[model samples]
Target: MNLPNKLTLMRVLLIPVFLVFFLIPGIPCHYLLAMIVFIAASITDALDGHLARKHNLVTNFGKFLDPLADKVLVMTALACFVDNQMIGVIPFLIIMMREFMVSGLRLVAANSGTVIAAGFWGKLKTAFTMVTIIAILVYLSFSGDFNSFSLACADTIDRVCGWILTGLVWISAGLTVISGWIYLRGYWKFIDPEA
Candidate 1:
């Protein structure tokens, strides 16, 4: 396997670690650990693609699995956040619906002898999603500290983070829709019913 593919696999390996950090309760610094792990995994996502392109080591397997890995990691994180009640259901639904729709469209394009690749908007969406998830997780990790006080500082921080997360979620969702449309448009010419 090429370095890029190895990096992609490393990202897949980190998913469980990320989840573990997110789920662990009252670990003193669980939120910080989760944020660090998530950031590292997000970095690997970028490094894999850059290495694949710059080193001329891109492979068919990488092409097929890289995006799939991204989708899985992102969708997993989103589900976990929703399950933990860190984010709203509407945003999760929008983001997940876009992912499913795009994945289905990509499959259709693949069968039609075309590969739909991630564009700028898609990358931006991923970045925003990662940022939002990290922020929300960190907030959750600290919200426990506010349980005793009527006007706790932790509660204030959580509310601020909540607003920021909501904004990021909407931005990510908008970008997801735009990116999906771009890919669909690119593949439209090749998707013939008779073919």
Candidate 2:
């Protein structure tokens, strides 16, 4: 395996550690630690792609696994937040639906020897989603008890972070939908029933 591929694998490997820190209770500054791991994983995402393109080390394995690793990592974070009642299900569902649609489209295109690279909107969505998740982690870390902070500071932190998080989630979802549409529009030929 090349260096880029190794970084991709490292991102996947960090997911379990992220889960442990985010989900397990009683760990000191658990949210902060989880955020750090997540940041590390996110950095690998950028670094691997840059190195792959720069060094011509891109491989079929890297191509296949990189996106899968990204989706899994993001989904894990969103699902954890949803389960912990930090965010609602609507944005998660929206983002997830977009991903499923895009993935299905990719499968169809791949069947015909086509490869669709991610669009600008997709990249934007990813950036926003990562920032949003990080924001939530920061909020939780400082709020005292990830699950029960709202009860403690229901009037102040809860209201402020809630609004900010909600805005970020919706913006990410919007970008996700737009990106999915861009894919569908650009590749309609592959999935056109009346073609």
Model 1: per-residue Cα lDDT over 1-195, one tens digit each? 889999999888988888887778666577667778788888989999999999999999888778878888888888887887776788788888888878888888788787777788887888878887777666655565334334647567656767887787788778888887787777766665665
Please report the candidate that would top TM-score against the real structure. Answer: 2
Q: Which pairs, if any, clash in model 2?
A: none
Q: Candidate 1, 73: how far from true, in Å?
A: 1.3
lDDT of 2 by residue, 1-195 (tens): 999999999999999999999988788888989999999999999999999999999899998999999999999999999999998999899888888888889989989999888778888889889999999898888785445564756777678878988898888888888888898999999999999
Estimate the TM-score of every prediction.
0.86, 0.94
* Candidate 2 ranges with C-alpha deviation above 4 Å: 145-154
RMSD of each: 2.7, 2.2
User: What ranges in model 1 sit over 4 Å off?
Assistant: 142-154, 190-195
- Per-candidate Cα lDDT values, in order, are 0.79, 0.90
